[model samples]
Target: MDDTPREEAGDEGAPPGGILDGTQEKSAQGGPPPPARSAPRRKPGKSRDHSAKRLANAGLAITAPTSRALGSTTIGGQLSAQLGTVAVSDTRGSVTQISYTATVSATNFTTTVGGNTSTISKPNISYWSGPATAVSGVGVFTPGQLAAANAIALTGSHTAFAVTSAVGNTSVSWNPTIIVRVPSSAAAGSYSGTITHSVA
Candidate 1:
């Protein structure tokens, strides 16, 4: 019998260490495979800023009698026309002051009947400020204070009157009185005239 070692039957084509298929190769230094390199992260973008603004304004209005008729009067007697309440409103900004003006159309009342002219001179018209109100600001009635005793006179020329020293919206109301003193020798036949009131 031959004494030579016998070769393994089906192992002739196998690799030296017999490594398995699908196994990953180890690092040469034997440490865990270097962590898989990751893609670099991006720095955050720069931030930006973002705001708003407005202006102030104002307005005015008036409510009062547009016309009146004082009936017959005796010779040398006085005729009084009581025009109803006169109310003024000032709509303004928070820091704005309130004021207004008053005016009359003419100083004298004139009429002509059958080509004969008649005149009523020096017609007295006045206002007494009463019952005032204010909102959203202080109420300062300085140069515009009105009272019965300190009534303001209306004439042909425009006259400015302060309504309030306050810094916001304000309102003032009052009754107006017109007095006409008839002359002893005056000839009357239903006299008519106009009185105009204005505010600013």
Candidate 2:
């Protein structure tokens, strides 16, 4: 026998050799498993501002001339006085055939988130005679009646007559005057009125 241990080689009862329970094992140094793979952080919520804009109010105005005149006469003359017509003008001094007109304007605007808007209204006008109490008369005379009696000629007459007596001239004056009246019920704005006349 050799001095080394003898090799007892032949094991006749072991099953045929083959691989079993195969699996991979990671190394001990893989940087803590990639920090446990946390889900991505969510962004913070943001705030928004919402506000509305305001709108402006609307307005209107009306105006015209102060006075108007008719016809004239010369003294010491027997004549037929025909006082022509008097007319009332509009704000632009243009006579409107149908009726008067008013202009409303958007003087300002109120702004909002939606947009700008305007409000509007109309002006009013009132009319009255300056002298509310004035005299009006009519006379009827037959032909040749004046020659048979003492009669007074008249001024501002529908018939042919001469201006004779100077008394009560101020009251007898044919100038028809009118006054513009604005009522308390009227809106906060300007207004206008007119007087119209005709010759007979």
Candidate 3:
């Protein structure tokens, strides 16, 4: 018997005679194997819906001095008698002139007057004075009618009088008064006039 063993042939279910094929097959012969299949892609989830809403809220609330009268309540009276007064004097027996101060006070008054009611919710009072005049030696001094230098200065010390009530309750009151002085040159005479007061 020969000593050499039989060589394996290709396709005989046996090893090839050479060690192994070194060159790679070209795609033209059988083409590279199909590329690996990838898993199906998933779609992105929908974004969260964002919508604005309008809201509203509502709430509601409801909210709301001094001169003397010359006559009686039924009529009127000198409102400043007790609160104010005037005085005069002569020095050397020479003719002198003097002027009296006029003052008005309101007791129960309001910012707005509707018939008998006032719009003022609280009580308030004010006072005012007129300008002063000088007396000359042996000369006459007559106090001019108390005129409001301006609308604001008319009331003298107390310009506006406000109160919650009139006489009984005593909610509020203003007592405005004035005093007069006579110089050696002042004249004597009775001075009178109407002091106007408006509720409104």
Candidate 4:
């Protein structure tokens, strides 16, 4: 039972120049060559601001005015400031503990020149966590003293400050010592007072 009337072959088992040949046919111009399109997919990249930065480096020099020393208790003439913090943490895979804090500003010590007036009790600080060398006393505000304001934590608790490594912008230095005290009834013409130092 086999009818001999068959002549239909447009795309099936018919190869000779493409038409559904064996390997997906390929001859008469692009057909099965456009199904391998895998070059149109890209959407991954968005992040900026490495983060973290704190710098305070300004003129600091207080040790004049007749060498400060009226009488009795005297320790005037002390100024230092070199705290830095520029970090990116690079990538932060682990180990991270960086801290910083110190404050001061008119906690005491004022002078209204003339009219009889004097001050000498709001200047005493000391800190040296890195790079130190400034004559008299040697930083640490006389043992890290701030007297008031409350905000001195250069490396206390909080993992004692740290900077293991992350990637870029890595800096860590501290040195703040400004202790000035004048007793003996501090009172004399030409007496100025103004203290302010902060970092966090």
Kindly report which residue stretches of model 4 are placed more than 4 angstroms away from their true locations once superposed.
1-95, 103-108, 113-182, 188-197
| Model 1: per-residue Cα lDDT over 119-184, one tens digit each | 666444343333343323455443232445665544544332345565566665555555565565
Highest TM-score model number: 1
Model 4: ten consecutive residues of lowest lDDT: 18-27
> CA lDDT of 40 in candidate 2?
64
Clashes of each: 0, 7, 37, 5
What lDDT score goes with residue 116 in model 4? 53
In model 3, how many backbone clashes occur? 37
**Tens digits of per-residue lDDT for model 2 on 1-200?**
11222111122432222001101111112113465676666567643323221111111111222232211111111111122221222122212221222111111111121243211111211111122122222211111112313222211212111112212111111222221222233222211112222111
Better of 3 and 4 by lDDT: 4
The global Cα lDDT (0 to 1) of model 2 is 0.20
TM of each candidate vs. truth: 0.54, 0.17, 0.20, 0.20
Candidate 1 Cα errors over 4 Å, as ranges: 1-58, 101-106, 123-138, 141-155, 158-161
- Candidate 4: residue pairs that collide: 125-140, 125-141, 126-140, 126-141, 127-140
Candidate 2 regions with alpha-carbon error over 4 angstroms: 1-173
RMSD versus native structure for model 4: 38.0
